[model samples]
Target: MKKIIAFAGSNSSKSINYELVKYTVSLVDDFDIQLLNMANMPFPLFSEDDERKYGYKNSLVELKEDFDEADGVILSVNEHNGNPSAYFKNLIDWISRLERKFLEDKYVFLMGTSAGKRGALGAISVTENMLPRFGAKVENVFSLPEFNMNFSAKTNTITNSNMEKEHRKQLDDFLGKLIKK
Candidate 1:
């Protein structure tokens, strides 16, 4: 079975982006899905001094291995004042140090969500553009706006019919690529 890694680029335990990742991957079948939480994989803020002093951690090697082995990625990023969260940015910085193209040849289904109406669009736009620089080809993008009104934690799915339709459509397209020759 093909393997895909799903993660939300947020440090919060109760991230809306994480909820979106779960909802998106729940609809997929017959594939190996590794759901990761950045909160569980915490690292200190990236700094050149730290890298020079400590070298690379063994954990970083294992993390790189995960990226190398995956066929695709499911990433939902959090917005912090119209920018990617510091935790995610720091993670990327560390990962990039291991290899410039750590995500090379991987197809990514990118998403973001927020409590307000903009739906983390600003963060998504920047991430979508920057990910390619690290060699992730973003195949699809979704932004779930007004998380309180649109998603239900009890149901573990998108509550809004129109948004759910679009979300599923995008998810299906990304899944097709993984299952396709």
Candidate 2:
């Protein structure tokens, strides 16, 4: 089975993006999905001083190895002021330090969700534009808008049929590519 890393790009205990990630990963029929927690990672702000002081933890190195070991990635991001949550960005900063093109040649299913109608479209757009610089081969993207109304975290499923179908199609496309590799 292809191993995929699924994670929400937020540190919040009750992140909507985490719910979306769970929902999205459910559509995958034959993959071993490992859910990663941002809250578990401990690192300071991205600075040369911090880098030198910490010298990268074993967890950070292991996290990078997780990415390197995966066949693909499923990312659900949280939006903060039309950008990725600070915790996610900080993770990216640390990851890039280990490898400039951290996502190079890796298949990524980029997605985001928010409480508003736009979902996390803003953050998705930002990631789409910039992640390629770090070698993100983002093949598909999805955004869930008005998350509170359309999705229920307790159920761990998308409520709207149309939205659910759309999400499935995106996941199928990504998985299709991943399996072909």
- Give the alpha carbon lDDT tens digit for every residue of 1-181 in model 1: 9999999999898898998898888988998999987778888889999999998888777888999999999999999999999998988999999999999989899999999999999999999999999999897999999999999999998999999999988888888888882
Tell me the deviation in Å of residue 50 in model 2: 1.5
Q: Candidate 2: TM-score?
A: 0.95
> Which portions of model 2 miss their true places by more than 4 Å?
none
Task: Please provide, for model 2 over 1-181, each residue's C-alpha lDDT reduced to its tens digit, 9 standing for 90 to 100.
Answer: 9989999998887888887887887777789899887767667778879898878878888998998888889999889998887888888999889988867788999988888999899899988887889887897999889998888777888887898888888899999999998
What's the residue-level lDDT of 169 in candidate 2? Answer: 89
**What is the Å distance of residue 26 in model 2 from its true position?**
2.2
Stretches > 4 Å off in candidate 1: none
Cα TM-score per model: 0.97, 0.95
